[model samples]
Target: MSHHLASLMVAGGLDALTYSSLAFLIASGLTVVFGMLGFLNVAHTSFYMLAGYIGFSIASRTGSFWLALLLAPPVTVALGLAAERLLFRRLYAAGHTPQLLLTIGLAYVIAETTKMIWGDDSLALAPPTGLGGHVVILGATLPVYHLFVIVITMALVGLLALLIGWTRLGMVVRAAAIHPQMVDALGFKLSAVHTFVFLVGLYLAAVAGVVMAPMLGIYPGMADDALVQSFIVVVAGGLGSLPGAFVVAGLLGLVQGFGSVFLSDYALYFPFVVLAGVLLVRPLGLFGRGGA
Candidate 1:
């Protein structure tokens, strides 16, 4: 292996773009629920972690990453809907503190349940047939899977932007976020909208885990790592701003990716440094209306 500083930096940039996309997928769910629903659900990352494990299992048993990718999101979405009816619905009026506690406890439960099912070992899956290769970029080797992840996530961003920005359903979602009571008073069932949004969030998390399962591996501790990233993205992007989530995700991804290559010894701390700097410069985050 030879060191090429410029090629290394480009590699880092590709890594950043891929990572930021995955983070955005996971964090978007958290931001949507927190920003639009006005309640913090810390257990969201559990869905992401669980999806990776589940998708891995499916791929292992069936030898088909395609099936795993298709099946995982719906399964996770179903679980989210169940949580809404059986657990989260009760917490709607309990405010953030109780919601936080309940979700924290739920996160533990999900983690433990995952342990019982998957054991404590970390698991990896092979990328889908077409994605398992390498591509050359700027005199450096880039994983084809990384570029694939970026394209899929970008497609998702476009789909979400269109759905939330133009559709009637999106109008209802925005209305619910801004004024739930008014939406309910206007003859639309707000609970359904809430359930839909929550499921969308969970689905997104599952999709992220499924797509990145090969890169990130599967383990019980994955949820905690994801939660930390989610918190940063949510805080940095501003609460309730999906567009902000996209920007912040990309920013943090680049910061961490390049920071690791340039400051390898301090790579672990670089992300937090970026977060702190962003906070100091604008406590409200880049697009947030106010600090959390």
Candidate 2:
């Protein structure tokens, strides 16, 4: 009985790790954008879904996973620019409710547009040539594609940490995050910083979509659940706190991944429940310091 219990725990841990990797990929971009811009950007998940479609279309036509990976980010960046210039900028000073409404509306528009372009059917992509098998570890079989997801997510996180910690742009971003009034008083172009941050967020979302499309088939409302999940992650991790986002996202992913095995009917809500509990205990979240 003890041996069986230990094996189950090991399997659950591996599964949690896999799911956490996916969640990290999905949430990191959200964390960065929200942390920097102070906007919820509800349409973030739409970008994720769109990237999956874009990648799928490209790969299906060209049979080149590399092309899909390389092309999706730039395309999403362009879209993000347009969105910021045309829509989001207008709501920047309109207060949070208005901004939230605008973003929610944009989410619907993007979803509908995606449906018109890709139809209401589901789509999938094959893993790249090199990452299309399984490997065994600790008496458990794990998909190679998941391994790729884990590696890519960890690399991106490291790169982001370096960029934010050691680079000029990162310095500006950190300054803005810590002291927006001071940054603006110093004559920094806050608008440009916001635009750059939005673009990067969109790029990350697109990459996640492309990579995850193989595992999760793309559909019309594919981003709805993701959007909710990410919001919970953001809230639970603490608003505008990147490190907090990473921690909460990993925690939620582990709970959802493992909880599903035991409570499939309520698994999807597990993260939200955790979020609620966290909010009740520490309203500012684990990492969030009182005001941005």
Candidate 3:
């Protein structure tokens, strides 16, 4: 291949990696919450989109990215808590179809609420001053914002790993994931633990939104596609497996990123193809255990 062709290929590969990181960021939270709580949070993507809108609003009004970064997640956490307490708690004993229907209804409610509040116009978030330019790497120029996003995502993933592996709360979460009945038997409040897990998932989704807003341009239905994509990641990675979600998210992101270049309009369906194949081969998912 010509030197220029080689450079373009390398750049495309890096871009794919960048995209995968975003997918991982979005998917990890969904995987953790779903895996631990055994509840499919169909409204999770709304939290993601709400984060972007919240962050954008704050940043635009105050011109302080730091404030937006700090504020959005907590707001999302509160929302998650409200949903869990008011809606999800009732659905815990309900059948899967009812639980799913409730969540799906909640998703529509959130989307419509967002539209009512933010309008249908697309909104763009300005990158922080430090990440507002471009950087050249390996004879290719890439957006500094995207590089920052990749770094932040890696740090978030590492932090999540540490939280799950080292902290007391993490221990409870892990225990709940592995043996919820046992955890409750041991005197831990299952409701409290699930609430915490749900909040954490919402926070993660919010962070993903804040980071993605600059790239995706926040809009009313911004999270519609993301909801489906996250489901694909969760199922592909094996439901409830945090590490599996990361691996599958990365794979899907890479496939979509590179496939889009070649397949153009059809790239959106690439992850589904991989998902179908994986399900056929291993119905349990890449890392999902048959139970728990």
Candidate 4:
């Protein structure tokens, strides 16, 4: 193969990795919240978009990318927690239709708020100091920030696995997801668990937003796009399965990246195509519970 062609493929693969990784980070929170509570949060991506805009605003004001990264996700998490407490708490058992509509309304409110704050124009965020350059990996020159994103995301996933798999908190969250009544009977506060887990999920969304801000920028329409992509990931991977989301999001991300490279005009359809195929075969999703 020509050197140029090989370089193109490598770049495409990296792009795919980047997209898949970010998609997982963003979608996992929604998946977990649904898995445990069986309530889909349509406003989740609003948190992601808010994080990006917040990060950009801070970065632009202070001229410090590190500060933005450090500050944005926490702020978004706090906002999400507030929304959960004041708004979502009232709708936990209201069925999917009402929750969906209300969250959509909430998302709309958030989008308008962002427009009022940041204007309608997209805003750029520079990468942090050490990540402002490229690095050679496997004979390919790649953006250091991209590599940093991939590595940090891997660690994030690992930490998540440990939290959910090895810790008491994870056990409680999983048990609650599977059987809230049983956990309640066992003397645990189901509401507290739900609130805590929801915050964790929103925090993950914010992390994804902050991490991707440099590449994606802050824009008015980002919330809508992110919502679509995250929903696809959650549904395709299975409603409540983080591992399933990781695998499916990775594959779909690759499909999107390579499709855009090899078949640019068709790239936009890849996500829906994958989603349709997944639903046609396994309506419950790849790892979704039969009860779910």
Instruction: Please tell me which predicted candidate would have the highest TM-score against the true structure.
Output: 1
lDDT of 2 by residue, 1-292 (tens): 7765565566666667767776767776787777776677888898888888888888888999989988986887788788889989988877778888988898999999998999998887779997888776655566788778778878877888898899999999889877888989999998887787778777777888888887877888779878877888787888667778778877886787678766779987788788988888888887877864
Distance from true location, Cα of 144 in model 4, Å: 1.3
Candidate 2 residues lying further than 4 Å off, grouped into runs, are: 1-7
**Order of all candidates by TM-score, from best down to worst?**
1, 4, 3, 2
lDDT of 3 by residue, 1-292 (tens): 5876666766677678777887776777778777766677788898889889889889999998878988987887788788888899998777678888998999899898888888989999888888889877777777888778778888887887898899998898889888989999999998888888778778877988888887888988768788878888888889788778878877786777677666768987788997997888889899977863
- The residue pairs in collision within model 4 are 36-177
What is candidate 4's lDDT per residue for 1-292, written digit by digit as tens? 5876777688778888988989988898898888777788998999999999898888888999888888999999999988988899999988889889989999999999999988999888889889989876555677889888888888888898899899999999879887889999999999999999888888888988888888878788888898889888888888688888988898888998777778989988999998998889898888776765
Score every model by TM-score: 0.95, 0.92, 0.93, 0.94
Provide the lDDT at 110 for model 4: 95
* Candidate 2, lDDT over the whole model: 0.80
Deviation (Å) of 91 in candidate 1: 0.8
Candidate 3 deviant stretches above 4 angstroms = none
